[model samples]
Target: MRRTKVDRRVKLHRELAEFIDMDLKMRGASVILCEIYGKWKGLREKEKDHEVVWPPMVIIMNTKLDKDDNDKWLGMGNPELLEYFNEYPAIGAHHSYGPQGHHGISVLIFESSTTGYFEAEGLG
Candidate 1:
């Protein structure tokens, strides 16, 4: 069972990498896949049992954007994009940053699930 779980994670990581590569190839975007793992901190005393948690499969995309138009690059006012992202997970957030000093506009994507804040933090 443990091996199965590990295998599944590996498969998922590969699939995501492939998908990102294909989807962004034409646009000249780069992706980095990483996981954020930590201990859970629950809202209530009963829920505060210390347990390891994996948040989500995080995808950080590096895409070129104009320095003069950060809002347009960040997709700050795009309701449709926001809605589409929200549909994929139990809970999630998206933000774009940069074109600062060295980096282009970076888009952060994550899968999230939550009961409360703690559950959100420990999104699996």
Candidate 2:
């Protein structure tokens, strides 16, 4: 007998994400994405770690905003977006957004190694 357990009021939401990892060989799916966002905070000049390396990146910035606005993307503004660049420093934003920022960044970041923010902490 197949018992179908149904819980009322149980609305399900789905989250999707992608990233390339040597450990997973690009296919773990432990989660569509990392359940966590916050990693490190502030980094310094001198520290030793393995994950703290300049990884490859693939970005798709606010194409929905402006193709020329490399400095900025979306409402994030040229400055805020650049700040992200200087901080983690991505390769570039692809800007594959639709007419609205809703389907924003559909195929950028993640999987693209460098685009992902490196934990600011841990000096390296």
Candidate 3:
């Protein structure tokens, strides 16, 4: 049986979200999915590189993340799982400057998936 485009996407997101929640919790970092959008890449794209480098799926994070953290998260990816979703993992970070401190956050990336779902236990 074949799946429609929307069905494939929904399944992909469900699996991706579950994967993220499990890995983040294992790392002892609290994170929540704020939103997911298709038209925008992550916040740290270079001006000239604004073009969509990968697929349109973008996962917005509610908690701050660093490159190291993102690396760890990506490292947790399973090859079989990725193949199941037909997704290629890409990691991105957001750069923001503020008086309190700088906000350079890291995030997981995927080739195909829509919808953002986040869960957190304890975040500092």
Q: For model 3, what is the C-alpha lDDT against the true structure?
A: 0.39
**lDDT minimum window of 10 residues, candidate 3:** 115-124
The per-residue C-alpha lDDT of model 2 at residue 79 equals 48
**Which residues of candidate 2, in runs, are more than 4 Å off?**
1-55, 58-74, 77-79, 106-124
Q: Candidate 3 residues 1-124, lDDT tens each?
A: 3568889989997987687556556666554544322223443455644444333333333333334533332221233323433443432323344444434332334423232211110110
Ranking by lDDT: 1, 3, 2
Candidate 2 residues 51-109, lDDT tens each? 53344333333424443444433544434454555654443433344454323442223
Please list the C-alpha lDDT of all candidates, in the order they appear. 0.42, 0.36, 0.39
List the candidate 3 regions with Cα displacement exceeding 4 Å.
1-3, 35-124
Which 10 consecutive positions of candidate 2 have the poorest summed lDDT?
Answer: 8-17
Error of 2 at 59 (Å): 6.1
Q: At residue 96, what lDDT does model 1 achieve?
A: 54
Candidate 1: stretches off by over 4 Å:
1-53, 60-65, 69-81, 84-87, 94-124
